[model samples]
Target chain A: MPENSAGTLAPPPAAKPKIKPPRRFAGTLYRGREGMWSWVLHRITGIAIYFFLLVHILDTSIVRISPQAYNGVINEYKTPLMGLGELALVIAIGFHALNGLRIILIDFWSVGARHQRLMFVIVILLWIVLVAGFAPRQIMNIILEAQGHGSA
Target chain B: MTTETIPAPRSSYTPPRKRRVNWEKWGWLYMRVSGLFLVVLIFGHLFVNLVSGAGVRAIDFAFVAGKWADPFWMVWDTLMLVLALIHGANGMRTVTNDYAHRPILRKTLLGAILVSTVVLLVLGILVIYTFDPCPSNAIAGTLPAFCKAH
Candidate 1:
């Protein structure tokens, strides 16, 4: 409500400059750094995980056919290729989950917004740790299974 | 008693449709709530199934049967199946809304997602509940230790 020294009150400058359309398309407000990339990662990982969920449900339903049938299909998942695929699956899920938690924190916690970039780094670190813990063990299992030492 | 009079519409007014629930709000809440539960349930699932002894190699018919034989694991899996599927469906719905600009394509994609989510929910629940962890015809050694007379 403060007025200029000259006289009557005047409105402040527009909240933000109006964006002008370019003759041809350029980029967008997506030039935002860490937050933008985290959002992009979240969307991509989410879509990938959703599709995997559909396939996983269908594959698990093979159990309804018969024990032998289920084993026949599931054993294929133990192959080297599928093992690597599973490893990739684990990585995707880890990022989605850890980043998801960061999102929840940012939404619910008062201070979360101030430290969102830091939280993203934490999410990545946690995801890395998660992958590190599981990868070596799963890789070993893959090797053992491929070598025919799967006594299980 | 004096009451404030409300102004009528200056032009023709259409009556509002029955306002009941805000589905978009519900979807937002569902994402956060289900995401929280899935973080715990799915991590536990992975730890048991993948990080445990023998890892994925130990997963076969018997291993699954051994776990499902217990009522607790049965319920755990059922909760996980329902929550995770719905969460993924809702997330995909958001993605579709963002990207599918053509109205018909958007509707079709949304309809497909809805149908698939429902079908999978029914299928998964049926599998979890109706599962017979022990079959009568199974070979003796192939059965889990819990199955009687195996």
Candidate 2:
């Protein structure tokens, strides 16, 4: 071999061809993890809200349809079970709003990633506020009504 | 027939793993989990509001008043509201991030989503808490019979 043969050294052997790995389906359709799950919930809830909106509009439209019928439907909303239903709707709107703020931060600015946990905490705290504000009035009314001092 | 001889195998190839963390993984998990919860909340809400009793016909002002008369229902409704809202907002956020490429447009849309959701949530909670099934001095037919005590 020439003294400088190391330079050629058969070009130190050709590098192996790179192989592309198999595809990963982990996060497909936003089903991969927590944040994506939050996104999924958001979309699902949004659609649900829309669906509920249609029902609500039609239900309320009963006012134009017939006062008796409207009163009948409105009365149903006052049931204990239905009262709970309305409460859930309130919380849904709350979560959607707070998480939305978090997402807006992620999309428009870069701060979301740095404060994911904090944002989530804030979301929960706000929900607590919502509950605190609404739950008492409802409960108090219910109690008062049961006590024969109902305020309607 | 003449054929080429096969060559001997060399060393086995091992794949290298990168140290980079994956954010996409987390996003995927979020969608499935949130979606699972939403199914329960949405269906429960529908069943209670539209399907129970005399179907949709049973819902009305007094119907709502009757329901709100219970504290248990109050908490239930509150939970549903918070969960569904958060789920929806987060989902829209994903869509915005994926499609809204421009910074200004993305921020604006996100801002709009945030503002509308908050305003609606506030108004909704207020309505739920402040709901009055019957006001004082209302016509007899206009009020639920129980309002007489007030």
Candidate 3:
């Protein structure tokens, strides 16, 4: 017991438990490799595609109103910004679908668990090939349109 | 008479625990099942909208109206909409539970997801069911080309 300024006996100060500082970037998005990275990217692309689906549904549903109204909304998608956005969306979908396949294989196939890392690598490689095949054409179109040499 | 008291025999039957709903397990199952369906639905959707016939340029009000005129397309679109939305919302719920450290934040995120998913589903369903390609009161110039025939 310790005495206060009034000289009355008071409860002794509680022992302070030693708290360790958290490691640098502990429990963060950047902390993991391979499977962890796949998990994080899968969550991210899933969310992105989810939001895209919401917008796509809403936009497509607008055709019920009138043609002009629907076209007015969709015409904005022709811009360079939207073209790039579409490219990103394609990339997201590519990764999500591939990674989802990997996940399915892991869950259902006996040998999938053993080669999950290999599967992840394959997914990434396939994703790169898909994006590489898709993006350049889109980028070229955007650039060509910007330069006023628009291709029909 | 040295009769030894026998210890009571262990109960042969163990009591069953109360059965609670296993929501997580069901949610996991739903993701896989719905995902399998989504692969086919989504790829078909993309193929039609971007590859079939005249491709993306052919997609417009008339195209959608033509497709919806068929009951098969209507059913396909509706099923895709409902399945994908539920799958996505449930997947997001898992993400929120994993990452959202604070209780209030987690609940709020989940609530938002639920409300948005429900609202979108309702809106999509309404659009699918109530769609009229050829409205009587439509402005003549703004109407889809097919509507002109009527």
Candidate 4:
């Protein structure tokens, strides 16, 4: 036994490779660039919209729940802060919508690789239109009311 | 000893169909383009809502009801709803196509996406427009009298 223990070489210990923190921006969209950022943002907004949708449904159901509570919630929205929240909802919905349209075109195979920029421009323009059209009222309403003048 | 003389080689044959553009080329384009838009739409949305003011605490029922009450917000929201749903559905459609190998399964999934998008869009729009924060027939002490035609 002593001879065998001494003569036989112990099995080589398997090398435990150092595990680096999983690459921070591994395989990010567009090499960790704008496109990647957009992608991450889109997914985040999508999830946000979905959560908002659930809350939205429940809140709307308050019409049946009790008008008092519904009205109370409604009044809460009149504040400047709530107005801003509405604006966010607008922005999220706008992005989701316009980009979604681009996605629709892609699904139909209407736009080709040559027109990626074209389509991107179109979606951006549409988003701009949506935001521009809605944001002013939200902003102005809050501003005017704060200054003691009703938002006309 | 026999010496063999090799014959000259004939011209090579070529297929005529190599010049066609592929459908997938279009699909790839769509992914990039749509992805670009989704970014702005999404981020703008986040900035406006969660970062603009008091953030998440400000969200409430009237907040939504008030927005929808206006035609401007109505149109904005309606557009957003339709677009987001379609973009999402379409995005999902691309993922489905890439993943669903079987022809029948692919078609079925695509069809489902189409149907669901249409249905959801319709329902969502209806909710936006037909929303009655204060119903006329609401129970006593429930509805604000403004809703009742005096």
**Residue A92 shift from truth in candidate 3, angstroms:** 0.4
Cα error, residue B68 of model 3, in Å, equals: 1.4
What is the i-RMS of every prediction?
Answer: 1.6, 10.6, 3.5, 7.7
Q: Each model's DockQ?
A: 0.54, 0.07, 0.23, 0.08
**For model 3, how does the per-residue alpha-carbon lDDT over B48-120 read when each residue is reduced to its tens digit?**
7643454443455667778988899999999999999999999889889989999999999999999999999
Per-residue lDDT of candidate 3, residues A85-150 (tens digit): 878888898888888888889899999877788898999999999888767666765665566552
**What is candidate 1's lDDT per residue for A51-120, written digit by digit as tens?**
8888888888877777777787888889999998889988999999998888888889999877788888
Model 3, C-alpha of B19: deviation from truth (Å):
1.7
- After aligning candidate 1 to the native by TM-score, how far in Å is the CA of B56 from where it should be? 0.2
Best by TM-score: 1
Candidate 4 regions exceeding 4 Å error are: A1-35, A144-152, B1-150
Once fitted onto the true fold, the runs of candidate 3 whose alpha carbons sit more than 4 angstroms away are A1-32, A136-152, B1-13, B51-55, B141-144
Tell me which of candidates 2 and 3 scores higher on DockQ: 3
Q: In angstroms, give how far residue B48 of model 1 lies from its true place.
A: 0.5
Mind giving the per-residue lDDT tens digits that candidate 2 earns over B98-136? 889999999998998787667656655665576566655
Query: What is the fraction of true interface contacts found in candidate 3?
Result: 0.37
Candidates' lDDT values, in order?
A: 0.85, 0.61, 0.80, 0.62
Each prediction's total of clashing residue pairs, residues at least 3 apart in sequence or on different chains, is: 0, 59, 0, 11
Give the distance in Å from residue B109's predicted Cα in candidate 4 to where it truly belongs. Answer: 23
